[model samples]
Target chain A: MLIWNRAKILYIKKINWHLCLIFAAISSQPILTSMTWKQVFSSSIGRKLTMGLTGIFLITFLIVHMGINACMWAAVYFKDDHGEMFNKAANFMGSMVVIRIIEFGLFFFIFLHIIQGYMLTVYNRSKRAVGYAVDYGSKGSKWYSRSMGLLGTLILLFLIIHWLHFWIPSRFTGVEEVEYNGVKMHNMFALMQTTFQQLWVVILYVLGCISLGYHLAHGFQSAFKTIGVHNKRYQTMLTGLGYAFAIVVPFVFAMMPITMYLGWVK
Target chain B: MEHYNMSLHLKVWRQNNSRDKGHFENYKVDGISSEMSFLEMFDVLNERLITEGKEPIAFDHDCREGICGMCSMYINGKPHGPWKSNTVCQLHMRAYKDGDTIVVEPWRANAFPVIKDLMVDRSAFDRIVQAGGYISVNTGNAVDGNSLPIEKDKADASFAAAMCIGCGACVAACKNSSAMLFLSAKVAHLALLPQGEPERKKRVVSMVAQMDKEGFGACTNTGACEATCPKDISLSNIARLNQEYLIASLTADK
Candidate 1:
């Protein structure tokens, strides 16, 4: 009788564990999916608060990503090494377990962001499908806000190619080697330079960066509002921050190729 | 200063009532003032119509100033008559000259039902507002603005959102016809204030439900609202609304 009771208890425990795991996974969906519109934009302040926070988070991610990629520009400029420094930098980035963990985090953030965006767009579409009587509104809304889905899709496509070319093959797949400066190096720098030198690759990079800029221009201020930071006194400052982020990060990213194309580096 | 006495053509929409079948009526207006407001030019045409023993075309207008948001018209492929940041009533005729053909139409949205020629019933916005758009400030709990001592920045943001005049321009300009901008303004205003704290989650829940119930289109972040809004309300408001919706949903206690 005692043995039978123990076996039953064990079975219940295993079942409970499986159920907990399933629930945990389900609970992590973007919180807005189940919310009412009132909850989404209940008040002007609430609306601004939410948007501001999300925008800032997205902008931060872009800046970090751009900074890491700037190493390519550095590699081109440092000619005597002829790719030695870049190769080391690439290897260092690949070898860092910390960077890998961050990369995973970035992947998660981006995936959730796109999913939430899609859901909002879908819900907005359904609601508008009913009947809208407002004769004149939205005359001042910017194009970036209007075409987020299209731009987001384009960025997503860029991300996929970006991963395949730089992340997936370079890190997950085996590293390729090339000889330079009488020394064999993990051809990561060579790969980067060659990729940038190609017209198509440069064009794609430029397009992606521009899209990122457009996204950030509105996104930064929106994120601040999301966290309840909307106020008149800081409005100009917040907008300035957005512009600064949008312009600087994309400009730096673009300069990498522009510089390379100009033959500023060997 | 460009001067040209423009003989212009117009295909204006005319309807007697919501149940009436609306049709296009053509008219020509000559010697229009280059500096005249778009509505003023319309007044000139209406005077001629009245003189001709015809009932002048009925339209809706409240504050000629852009603040009231009552004047709304779709001009030849653009909302609020082509000039950015100018409401239909504020749009100057100088924008067009020398025999330009214009098509004038009422703001078209599911929520807005046409009541007369170029006059739409935007009461759906009122319905959405009544559905929990206001802050649940308890009676006699008058809190001084300085009592909470909110950060100046938050206060400024709240003021900006509070500037929304409930105009339906965003819907007319939007391809999806989303009211996200309007909804965002309402949401952002209260969310920034401390008095709006206790029932924040419930407020958003009810208001958003009401907006959806009214048949307003979803916000796709196209920003046509910001471009055409006489107030130039920012698209950041919509993004903030999305974040609030997410947080409220996640943090709500069942």
Candidate 2:
């Protein structure tokens, strides 16, 4: 690690004089240097801050995921060709070295989120060793707001099913390849069509989408609030925007499987 | 409203100390007036217990008017009982019907350990407050309030945040037992004013650090704190604290 740091500093020297100084200044900051893993994970405020940052990253990934898949609709409606646009989009995303490198960061963030979430759930439960005897449910807060852990667990399960169904096939085990306009790519659209043929798969996907919606409903505005958007005016705007995104993004995603199962996107 | 007397069954938590695993002790009280406060009803039960050669149940209370925030009762699975924006002392017997069985417990956060019965040691809150809940001022004549030109809206918001009475109701109501609402209320109470401008950044950072050190849980945006707060402290203060912490963390010169 020391050697890597020296090498990186030397490399920065070759880049620009001002860039080297800025890098030096940034590297010397005490907050980054002083923070330990135990402190990061154990501190309640620090953990929540981590949740906010990671949650925002995942929220952005959803948009990208939905947008890339929406290529199928564009292919069908615009070009009167099935799976052409989607396959091309998938192949481009899959083949890029830069994208592949970023994929590691994506996975790291995803795992960090899930691990931190579980850790917090466990730790928070320990705060109240014994709960109230009388069951007063949802009077003080919204049920969904309090049920983030359950919703998150559901989303995690959905992600596992999703990885099994699509991510594994595309990344590890090769899917059937088809050439579209002289470029060979994994026929992910065809694979999706075949997968959606099963009623249970479609049902599971819809359930996953519903869980995602509720999770995002709380998580969207929550991320911003955690990062310090706490005023009444901006807060109201973000909340309204968050609820809309929660409904729309998940609806669009749920429609992906529905359209395929109904043969509307073949 | 028609006033009437009623008989009620009580399942009050009784513990000798923080270490002891407490149990609910049942007591039946007759001819309790609806006009009496909930604490008054407890007074009746304690009187009965002492006469019967039994120990009186211990609980904390002062300024039964709800301002001191000393009464920490988790009655019927809620902090400060069934009334909206109310403390247990302010809660009347009229809220319940005859023969109603009330389950009372203390603030069950790890930070606020049970002293005995329904009373818990809440010095954790004082420590958090000490961390950075005030503005450093010189010992001199009081500053003129009119000299400080402050916005009306911000002042109102600041005053609202200042209304937090150092109660653990927010923690009691929270599933995670988070002190975010309470801590944030403290942070915002000072942060919104010019007097707090000098230590604005340090106040939030240190307070949050103290809060985390105190073994409180993180806020999950459940809104339970706001709903059950007797002072009606808004959850928006928590959001403001988040923003303040983020800014402070990012820009800390040291």
Candidate 3:
């Protein structure tokens, strides 16, 4: 194939010099294409490894995300605190140049995970084209583990709405600005208060959080397993830790919208 | 145990070859003894088909006692049927009662293509094994068993992994048709032993690479394969494979 392409390119060189260069560029590369480092990471197991690594990174990001959002409960500690602490923490996260740069990396990883997740789901589904005539649902495995793709898609949908509510306003168009202790920044607190007023939005966010919980239920230990944490002791610990994280993280996140919607938080 | 006979209706997958578009063909067998193995019931049906001047349903089977992994059947939406840790040849008709409708099919995977009715070509498994073939031993006479001491847990784990018959049931039962369980079983079988030390890294890397080359799907860790495995191959082996491959690939000179 390489020789044939070279011969054709040589023949074309006599007729159209630019065409010959284009043909050579396109055809020659594949003819000599050998296994390289890039191909290594794109293989079946490698693709999963990519998912696992990126998933753990995203998991870490959620900690920061929830911790900062957890700042909304500052009213519990201080007198007449109206999301001031949450707003300041949110501002600190937003205005820092270091975080601003890392924001790109964060979104990049998120996008990579979403795209690769869908790709993996599609590829895996194709592995068994013709399914069994008799349905044996969830007898062999948990439904959530099999439905990661569905749960992930739900999370992605929620993200778009959540981002539209918060990310775009704060980053692109700018949020309603306010001064805390005479230091002026965006009143992301006010934005959250107003965003949760709609009952449908609150319901949707809760559903999103539920989906995220399930996604993490399978994904937390799955990421560990893929990265090679298979020992019985560590596995047992991780399984417990994974379930707790899955439940607590999403439950807290969901509560943010629920509390605001019900006027439980000021 | 008092024995009884039953009538059964079977919806079996039929295909001429890899290129042939397959469909389900139904067959009925009456007076099937409760003690007869599942394949023997098939034999009864095939004998009737012969008398009727119809083509006999072809399948793969050897050593009807279930030691040989040759028997491959997706009986009623599961590899090797309802019984846990049992192959098709060992599955008794006693599990069924009168007028039961049984659906049977070949292992559904791109890697395991249909050769005929209820039979798939599992050469892909052989290739994956061959990819991890041959541990290096200083060619010599047998040494003392105690020469290389191994822990009991490790030996038991390795023995469990070595019990894999390469039946392709894991692939059949897996939603993704992944060969991870089988591949992991092989990896764990060798990596736990002293004989497999020299080529440990090489074996895992090459076998996994070959598994990908065979067009199998990625492991999603659903535990379906472990559940369906006739040898009861554990999912821990898969986790171990993930560990092995991850470390090996990272440190690989390539």
Candidate 4:
């Protein structure tokens, strides 16, 4: 054990792992070291890996949030006193500890996702600064795929507004409502109905959902491919799945707002 | 492949450099064999031109076997000619018939500076690779390959990446002149293995830095690289590269 310790000390002393750690830490930091454009757009997997993981996580969050929102639909459709249910659910969730935890998680996920995405876009743009002389004619490719960064920025903006308007009030505002059966409900239906009724809000939500759909169309299959699921058996099916998710999620989510506007869901 | 006669008109692009304007020069060749490989047919044309005491048309080629990946030229507006799994040299005259007016030109990209005629300097790619493309394995280490039991699927995936010849055909084929396919191959090769984990973040960051310096375009996910590749490298590789880069940029040591 003594000899091993000595060897380890020698190894550390020789290679200076601490220095490497510092360098790596500095390089990895978003503020300290921004990636060059080549690094961002250099590899197929690199690009997809970034886009895919963030997309999966973001989409997962969206689905969960949408599911929660869909509870309002349940209340509206079932003809129950869902106002009470909403109050109970919101009060239970509004507990100090739970709200804090949820807030931290949301912040961490969104911040990391956006920071990475921004760096990648910057790298991509910078790398292609010089123009090509000859036209190789690889055009007629999909449009949405190329415009991910722009679409992502739009989504980010939506996320910021969403969190500011909804998440913040629900969490840090210290507001109270009701609790039932160990669940908190915050008159969310009323909040949503009133908020979503505004013309600009509805328009923005529609646009955001569309952008999310477009983002998912490329991002879904891209994630599958990133996780190394690229056999003939899965490729076509996976691609089909991407299209389905991209189209279905937005369509379903958008339906709620449209229905709300059309008075279909009360 | 059996020899057959083919009479074709060749419209080849001639350019001195980025500063010079380029145009097409046409040549008529008769009694060609469809069985002859595309490069071999060029050889025949060059021979005819040499005998006629004219400057032979210039093009690029290194390994005729398609392994070295040095040859890259757009034939009739298609990168690496019309074959699915072929390089410019591996392309056969059989892809065309008699009297076909084939147009040939070098890949156009500001990143890929031209040397002369159909030969463009692709050393920009070399710089990208040198800038943290490899796994940073020290020489004389003599590590056993099996010492690290990589998953079979991962091994196969790495093998696919290892097949990239750095031909720049992917960039040439891209409308955006994107090197996403090329960079993706390198990233996929390293990212699939455990040995590559140690330097993964640095590798991605540096390689991308080098790629940007080289002036390659962003990937639009058009997948032209897969279409034009002589080795049939996948666009999925590009996706993989993007994911790795994102992860690295997001959650690096910091």
Q: Pick the candidate with the highest lDDT.
A: 3
Q: Give lDDT per model, in order.
A: 0.69, 0.85, 0.87, 0.71
Please give the lDDT score at residue B185 for candidate 1: 88
TM-score, predicted candidate 2 vs. hidden true structure: 0.90
For residue A238, give model 2's deviation from the true position in Å: 1.5
* DockQ, 0 to 1 scale, candidate 1: 0.14
Per-model TM-score versus the true fold? 0.67, 0.90, 0.91, 0.64
Candidate 2 residue B233 Cα shift, in angstroms, is: 0.8
Per-residue alpha-carbon lDDT of model 4 for A157-250, expressed as tens digits?
Answer: 8767777767777666733444556754565556666777887887887888898899888777766666556466787898898898899888
Q: Tens digit of lDDT per residue, candidate 3, span B119-166? A: 898978866765664464444588989998999999999999999999
Enumerate clash totals for all models, in the order shown: 91, 1, 0, 44
lDDT (Cα, tens digit) per residue for candidate 2, span A27-107: 422222133455544567678888989999999998998899899897558656778888888888899999899899999
Query: B122-181 in candidate 1: lDDT tens per residue?
Result: 877754554446553334556676767889988988898889887788877776666778
Best of the candidates, TM-score: 3
DockQ per model, Cα: 0.14, 0.29, 0.28, 0.18
Fnat, 2 decimals, each candidate: 0.28, 0.62, 0.57, 0.18
* Top model number, DockQ: 2
lDDT-sorted candidate list, best first? 3, 2, 4, 1
Winner of 3 and 4 under lDDT: 3
Candidate 3 stretches with Cα past 4 Å from truth are: A1-36, B138-141
lDDT at A263 for candidate 3? 86
Q: Residue B195 of model 1: what lDDT?
A: 67
